[model samples]
Target chain A: MLSIKNLHANIEGKEILKGINLEVNAGEVHAIMGPNGSGKSSLASVLAGRENYEVTEGEVWLDGKNLLDMKPEERAREGVFLAFQYPVEIPGVSNINFLRTALSEIRIHRNLPPLSAKEFLKMTKEKQELVEFEAKLANRSLNQGFSGGEKKRNEVFQLAMLDPKLSILDETDSGLDIDALRIVSNGINKLRSADNAFVLITHYQRLLEYIVPDFVHVLYNGQIVRSGTKELALELEEKGYDWLKEELQGQESINTK
Target chain B: MMEKDDMMLDELANKEYEFGFVTDIDMDISEVGLNEDTVRFISAKKNEPQWLLDWRMKGFKAFQKQEMPQWQNFKMPDIDFQSISYYAAPKKQAKYASLDEVDPELLRTFEKLGIPMSEQKQLAGVAVDVVFDSVSVSTTYKEHLNEMGIIFCSISEAVKNHPELVQKYLGTVVPHTDNTFASLNTAVFSDGSFVYIPKGVRCPMELSTYFRINAENTGQFERTLIIADEDSYVSYLEGCTAPMRDENQLHAAVVELIALKGAEIKYSTVQNWYPGDKDGKGGIFNFVTKRGACRGDHSKISWTQVETGSAITWKYPSLILQGDHSSGEFYSVAVTNNMQIADTGTKIHHIGANTKSRIISKGISAGRGQNSYRGLVQMGSKAKNARNFTQCDSLLIGDQCGAHTFPYIESKNNTATIEHEATTSKIGEDQVFYLNQRGIDAEQAIALIVNGYAKEVLNQLPMEFAVEAQKLLSLTLEGSVG
Candidate 1:
């Protein structure tokens, strides 16, 4: 469903994502784990068409369409969803109103008729229950004065409402407590289907323990160094990333000689 | 990406003014110039009584001695009084008995303005007094209102039919000598609406006035006076629009509202006059003086205005709380796009004990527009335990626009309590991007954010006007992002 070939990106004239290559079929979950500055978030931003990140090289294809040529809004309409690391707080815009606008715009872009008010409320209520989001928060200003746990839950709620083809969770579990992590994971687990895909970008294996991935890839210095199964996450969690850093340094020395 | 955003801002700022069509109608236009004769000419044209003429003559003398104000935030343009025709009215001077007697062309003009008189009568439950150029052409539901001892008619008609009431409250709230513009309006004012609600009666419908500036080179100086008697309540609304012209048109007017004992009055305005082209070549220079006086104990007055047009706007709708326990409220949303400049706010004076006032102002600036909110809240020595609360917020879209706030508070009584809050913020790029990532375009995103920012003020408007104000805000700042 998604393909990225030799993707290179830069921010402020400094390379961030250096020649990233990845591919995933439908119904697959991929986890990219790395150290602090391995460009995990940068990869998500580039795929979501953030304006500041200049893609200097590479092509990204989503289902057959060139994703890089589209605007951020167009990319969203093409079913690319990025759960931001820090969700913006927009005061005065009701969360329900924002969701309605997004849903209508996406539906219009896909040549689908808009949902009636009754149907929309029903869907909202059902999704709110599915994510266990407080009903009162749905009518309040968009994410204003929300707690860290509530914000992550709102993101999952939006993910459920938008029903995107490919979802990228960028550090979704970084600020969550154990309970919030379990709830968010439960929402994502229930939302998983054969027609959708997920990419979990995290620094620790804590989130992986909740929603185990089919493939785990170790990212180092803007490149994927190793690919393995779920057991690899436990191994890296116990050993730490220092061993991987030393191994990469040894490989560089050998190449120079 | 920045260049692309800039291009979109330029396109949004350069959008054409929608209400800029000239209405072709014969007009009785006065010769250019302002002098003693001009005042006498207007007074004699209206066939005013001797006392009224004397009052105008006094106003003219006051205007002659006063100088143009210098303390406004924006630079004032030099206006040549002699070059502007003081009065212009439709040739059909007689009042229309019904919609059938009104000219088709004039009706079409109002039709284009979205307020067809024939339809308005049946649809909005709003009694409209249609003021074309300078004269009141038709007043709907006057007879219906008269059944309840309510007097709703043109000011000129009121002068002839109800002289005592007109003379008693004409300048009671905003005297002619208050300022240069007020003096000028009092001296050469043509015609506007005059509403009087009798004691103990609640007005059944909204009273409205639609002012259209169609005649070229003419200044619209209309005067409005509304008096709510003891135990009465009334809500009044006014809307103004002008055609496109290469030369600036002056609109200097005065509005006076009086609330007697146990009375309440709510006045709302949606001013959408022509704001000129992107280069700011020509538009209306709106200088208005609107004031309401709570004359008796327990009276209340509220002012809600959405000002989205005019190249240069200098207005401050004020309140004088002279009655003990009286309250005043002002809610305004001022939007300036392209090269427009607006400096507007409110003033509340607490003269009696335990008076109260509240002010909420929101200013939005886009393109090269500059918006300023200047407000004053004064508590007199006798105003013991008086209270005032003010909130001023400014939102800027695009890097070229500007927003400013100036608030003045004076409290002479130690028992008085006053609180003021102010904030200035730019439309965050991240906010727009976040919305865009959810499938909403940048234009829609900006509009959503702005409408939300101004929601507090917009909620104060009447239902029908609130919808229009929301649409106007979106249209004024469409796609304008920094």
Candidate 2:
């Protein structure tokens, strides 16, 4: 459902994603694990068509359409969703109102009629219950004065409302407590289907235990250096990334010699 | 990204004014220049009484002695008084006996302005007094209003039919010597609405007036007066619009309101005059003075305004709380876009014990527009245990716009309490990006954010006016983004 080939991106004249190559089919769950400054979030940003990141050399495709040529709003209309790590707090803009505008615009772009108010409210109620989000929080200003956990939950709730084909969760579990982690993971699990895919970008292996992934890739220095199954996450948690760095250094020295 | 944002701002700055079409009917326009003869000409044309004529003469002398004040925040445009005609009206001066006798062309003009003057098509439960140029063409539902002891008609008619009421209340709130604009307005003001509610009566319908300026090179000076007698209640609204012209037109108006013992008056205005072109070559120079006085104990007065047009706007709707236990409130939402400049706010003077007041102002500036909020809150020595609260907020769109605040507060009574809060913020690019990622376009996003920001003040308007105000707010900032 998504493809990236030799993706090279930069921000402010400094290269971030050197050469990222990845492919994922529908219904598959992919977990990208990396340390700080390893381009995990950069990949998510590039796929979402953030304007600040300049794509020096790359080709990204979603459903056979070139993603890099589209604006951020067009990408969103084309079924690409990025759950932000830090959700913006827009004071005075109610959560329900914002969602209605977004849903209507996306539907119009897809040649479909907008949902009626009753239908929208029904859908909102169901989704709020699915994500275990507080009913009061759903009616307040977008994310103003919300707790960190509530923000993460709101992102999950939005993912359910938009129903994008492919959703990239960027550190959705960072500030969540154990209960919030379980609720969010359960929501994502319920949303999984044979027609959709999920890419989980996280720094810890703990998130993988709740929403188990079919493939786990370790991204180091802007490229994926290791690929394995769920067992790889446990191994990394036990031994850490130092062993992998040492092995890469030894390989570089041999190649130089 | 920055270049794209700049391009959007340019597109927003160039949005054309919609109500810029002139009515093609013949008009009776006065000759240019403002001297004693011009004032006499207007008063003689209205067939005023000797006392009224003397009052106009006094106002003219005062206007001659005063120069334009220099304390405003904007660069005051040079106005040549001799170049502007003082009055203009439709050619047919005979009073129409009914809607059928009114000219079709004049009816069509009001129809184009979304105000149908015909009895069948007029807005329900609202009486409108239509002022075309410098004369009142028709006042809807006057006979019905008269049945309830409420007098709603043109100010000129009030001067002839109800001279006692007109003479007693005229200039009582905003005197002719108040300021330069007030003085000029008092001298040459042609026609406006006059409303009065009798004692212990509640006006059954909303009273409204629609003012239209269609003649070129003519200045529109209108006077409006409203009075609520003892134990009465009334709500009044006014709207203004003018045609497009290459040369700027002047609109100096005076509005006075009075609330007697146990009475309440609620006044609202949606000012949407022509705002010139993208280059700011022409528009209306709106200088207005509006004030209300709580004359007796336990009276209340509130002013709610949404000002979205005019190239230069200078007005401050103020209140004087002279009656014990009286209250005053001001709520305003002023928007300036495409080289428009607006300097507006309100004043509250507490003179009686236990008086209270509240002020809320929201200013939005876009596309090189400059908006300033200047307000005064004064507590007199006799004001015991009085309280006042004020909140002023400004929102800026695009990089070239500006927002400023000038607040003056004086408290001579130790028992008085005053609280003030102010904030200035720019529309965040991050906020726009977040909305974009949700599939909402930039224009709709900015409109949503702005309407949300000004919700507090917009909520104070009546239901029908609130919807129009929201649409005007959105249209004023259609393509603006940060």
DockQ of each: 0.78, 0.70
What is the per-candidate TM-score for chain B?
0.98, 0.98
Chain A TM per candidate, in order of listing: 0.99, 0.98
Name the DockQ score for candidate 1. 0.78
lDDT of 1 at A151: 88
Residue-wise C-alpha lDDT for candidate 2, range B155-256, written one tens digit per residue: 999999999999999998998898999999989998898999999999988898888778888998899999999999999988877778889989999999
Question: Per-residue lDDT for B138-191 in model 1, tens only?
Answer: 888887899999999989999999999998888878887999999999899999
Q: Which stretches of candidate 2 lie over 4 Å from their true place?
A: B94-112, B116-124
True interface contacts retained by model 1: 0.80
What TM-score would every model get versus the actual structure?
0.97, 0.96
Q: lDDT score, residue B292, model 2?
A: 97
Query: Each prediction's Cα lDDT score?
Result: 0.91, 0.91
Give one digit per residue, the lDDT tens place, for model 2 in A1-257. Answer: 89999999999889999999999889989999988999999999889888889999979999999999998889999988888999989888899999999999899989988899999999999999998988899999999999998999999999899988899999999999999999999999999999889999998899999999989999988888899999999999999888988898899899999
